[model samples]
Target chain A: MRLTYVFIAATMLLVHLSASGQSQEIPSVPLKALTGKHFDTVQFNERENPVILSFWATWCGPCLKELDAINDVYADWQEETGVELYAISTDDSRGIKRVKPLVNGKGWEFEVLLDENQDFQRKMNVVAMPTVLVVYKGKIIYQHTSYVPGSENKLYEKILEYSK
Target chain B: MVKKTGLLFLGLTLISNLSNAQISGSLESTGQRYVDDNKIQLDGEDAEHRYRSNSYLKLDYITGSWSFGVQGESYLPLSLLNYNPELKGVDIGTVYARYSNKKLGLDVTAGHFYEQFGSGLILRSWEDRQLGINNAILGGRVEYAPADALTFTFLGGRQRVGLGFDLSKGTLYGANIEAGLSDILAISTVDISFGLSYVGRYEDYEHRYLNGNNAHLVNSYSGRLSVSKGGFYSEIEYVHKGKDLLMNMGAPLIDGNKKAGNAFLLDLGYARKGLGVNASLRRMENMRFYSQHDLDGNVFNRGVVNYVPALTKQYDYALQNIYVYQAQPQYQTTPKIAAGEIGGQLDLYYKFKKNSALGGKYGTQVALNTSYWGGLDIEGDPETGMYTTKALGFGDKYYNDMAVEVRKKWSKNWSSVFMYLNQHYNRGYIEGKGGMVNATTATAETTYKFGKSQSIRMEGQHQWVKDNFKNWAAATVEYGLDQHWSFYVHDSYNYGLDKIHYYNLGASFSKNSSRVALSYGRQRGGLLCVGGVCRMVTEAAGFTLYVSTSF
Candidate 1:
């Protein structure tokens, strides 16, 4: 009976280790670290703010609409719950030039990041554009693919639910 | 003596555990048999076997902030060239190293990466498995952001060639900076942002074939802007390039001309409540947006893309797609041309309330989309000019496509959708330089669902041609068992000048984290178009299997 107990405990430990291995926590590297820029880190662990990460390209029509819809209400959300939205452009060097002009012209006020090499996209396992991931407390809580009308509202609700 | 025995037992146990970490992989093979009854070409039966098998081993070990993992994949006798049995060999697909720190807000990646710039006009490095297109960069990249409104990235690498075809080791480099100025430029009803980027490439070419060993520099600069207020939004982009623009006329061409080109695009849209509308226009001149000056065919050239033209008609029916519009890069060089041609597209959608009798119990959604696209001559000569500056009317020139769709839900678990399309395709405009027009096509499709997991989709298509194949028809039926599994059978019959029937049947299975699909089909000779470029795929009867997994 004693030997069986030891075997059971050992099996449980092994199972726990394997499960943890598959569920890797989302990396919290500073945006500068990924871009090869030097900057001071601003950690936001205490506030537990919900983070919206969107992968898009300038050439995708659906992506443009999705971002425009969110930009319409990004300010109100910030005032209410301090949510941070990161709009990552997967534009290559050729299209990279349009990123600034297009973003500035559209009047979007969210955080912008350039994944010129798609390193972040590959890590997050993104296969298509207009992919959105919602993170809470540095862990991915929800993810949605593609976009249609009124989807932004549903995303806003998810953010509000998690923030509270 | 007891301590030695204990150590030996421990050593044996470790060895057994290591052996249990199995190194296993998978193999997928396909074979095709083609039969042709043609008078012009030798006709009979030809059989070929094409197989692609990939194997990799993953080992995981973690220590502190560092974790290590490696994956290796090889294609034995790369299946892409299987149609031509003469080429056969093993090729490496990918290998990489990645590291991330949870505490330092740092993630570093060195090795190969796949990336893209906005819409890929100026720069896009990506891969499409079905098309066998992989443009991953062999280089290093780092990203960092410390503020809510600012982000920066610096990247440098070499463009990817095909497997075992990385000879012309040209250098590609670029950097991007984006800033969100909403707080700095405050407006209650508006938000604004800006970005700047530059990309340059160096290539060494021995034009010995063209008779010179000249090195050229390919540079591109792009700028974009967007504005939205209430229900209206607009976006504009401008791209400029230096001399020796690498343009892919979809065929072989010389590269050593001091030619420069520019392109501008505008998209305007409006959406409110149950209605939406959008319009777009683009004009380009001498723009050949290629990363390498010496390359013949690149989808994204610095000047303008000729194959993947923007569609006013996104034909979903198979027949309509057969004769789709393609871009013409040669039109940019007309000596008599004045202003570059301009093209535009429009889309609209509306919804009806459910209480209405026509909408039934669950309300109906109706959408009407129509688009007309044509080229302008600018100042080109009538006889020798590449393009004329004539305004594209309902049936004037270039291409015109119109489509309408109606969708409705009958009950809690039932819904249906119907669509119809009409198109006019000009072979001359679509084929570019010395290409001819083949025919015009019309098509329709319908889909019905029973409950959430079971559904059937059907499509019908037809083409009416003045010449060439004359007419064609196709139909397909699809059934879905659940979210993870779907089965479909389809057949396309040509019944005009020559009678030929092509049939295909396939099934796809999926479970949590993995998917496997198998299909057996006969493909008739035809043009397949994506975006705006078109390619002629051979006629064949074959079997295919695809598998994918994620963790």
Candidate 2:
């Protein structure tokens, strides 16, 4: 009973706090590509097209599942929704080397970016792997964490909703 | 407490008044209840605490280029293992305000923040809650990007010591600049980048040596270059640090002052449609970088400001990870500091053509890899923590590993993976056990799909070692029913000698944006690792729960 009471009180106190996601649509954080090029997320979506930013890593099992699911329908989703996906690898410097080889081996067709320093991950306040966010213009309209096979449908639906 | 409440109130006021503003946050909590068991005691861990919970809650308010946020963490009565004994009770993790303008190409951050420079060799301020570590800078940082091709950053802050802020430990200031040459040169196919960093740590204490008097300043410099074009890539970084005293972690602490720490790292790789190959080399000499100067130099705790991960391969197989490699920070566990280690690794991957005899309908992927590490050759005074070394001289082999793996997609419904590894580990030099360990590990895994939404996977692994638990074997099975529900059961046996069966069972469910998993098991815990940094997890029999969600 005491634990539950504390949880409730803390939740109430925390409900009043808000800042990270609601203020901007797309942050200006710089992410490194596998090819050593840097992609500024702010200027990445030049067309103002709906963007799907997915944060993941090499060692995350659920992330691979989510990416594989998205890959199955990515082309069709792009054709219909005019959306572009950026797979940001949250791997640290030690694991960054696996990015290119793994991506090529799996034949994933998304623009892969490396966050070796975790600067972007920290700025966005991402807490879990396979976190998917739907951004339009500069605002994050929908965000989801974790992964289930059917969850990809929800992401696609959010993309379609924001594309309108 | 008053400060925290004030910041929350200010954030709330801004959100309530601004229709154009937005606020969002996330929550993560893990709870464990321990039960006494004979096996845990046999593993030599004192289970004095019955319950432990670690939780974090964050809130952010943002509008346009301005943002502010606060983070709160609770270790409850005590933490699991009390990784940082001072990390108990409710506390504030970070509070910060930030502003970024894309048009002006400027960013400013004040309060608590995280930053890293050039691979974090010389400077890095960050957090890893799982490791019970958070060394974020508590001060101000400014970033200027006058052009698309060049960027500069300046920051000055005191490192977060233990659970709270300590001013007595002093401050660190750093400057970094990076040039994206490819962006300016308009090189369509080739990319090149260069970076330079300078970090100085200021501690006003009576050194009476090196620079003489108190107020010791340690300066470190790093330069990096990277080139990547399509499938070929190469990158290198070199770091040098000035003379300073530290609580030497590798040896018994008695005022271990070291001088001129340095390191070099290089990576090369190429990948194509069906092939990928990579090679990497690294050498470090007395390269222990820390923000604090008065620690007794014990591993895991004392608030390290930078992360120098073990440069060895990270394995996913349960048995292969047993004899893990930890970076020997200046010849671990000695009275006098000595040479650091040098090592290199090579990886090759090739996929067979589809419809080939071995590939069948889907191609088979074959991967081979090998890695070797050895102590640097050196002759230096140990009492002063000074050393000299030749790169790749290979004084004594500390670790060696070779492995081969094959992955095959047998059919639309089934897939399998097989792997084998051979390793030689110097237990005396690496794990500080005063001996040697030669081991071979083999593993097999398979997954079967049933219908559209169900699947089953199984794994079996075994390790043969001459020392410390002669042999070990484990088997795990997981069943996924529908897309949201999963169940798993596992058992590991030290059949070689201890002959103890460590058993576990768990289940999890995921829907939409949330996931909850609960497991009950006996953790004959030894070393638990993630991303090359490891800590010794205590043995215990417990029920554990993990929960997380995002907005």
Alpha-carbon interface RMSD for all candidates, in angstroms? 13.2, 4.1
Write the residue-wise lDDT of candidate 1 on A53-157 in tens digits. Answer: 888876564586578668767899998878998887875432343454445445567867776556556555555557777767655565665554345766787
- Misplaced by over 4 Å in model 1 are A1-22, A26-121, A124-164, B1-73, B81-90, B98-108, B144-146, B164-168, B183-186, B208-215, B245-256, B298-314, B329-341, B376-396, B432-453, B530-534
The prediction achieving the highest lDDT against the true structure is 2
Clashes of each: 62, 13
Tens digits of lDDT, candidate 2, A1-73? 5445555545554454433324444556787777766678776445567888899987776686678568757
In CAPRI terms, where does candidate 1 land? incorrect
How many clashes show up in model 1? 62
Among these predictions, the greatest DockQ belongs to 2
Q: Which run of 10 residues does model 2 chain B get worst, by summed lDDT?
A: B247-256
Candidate 2's TM-score on the B chain: 0.93
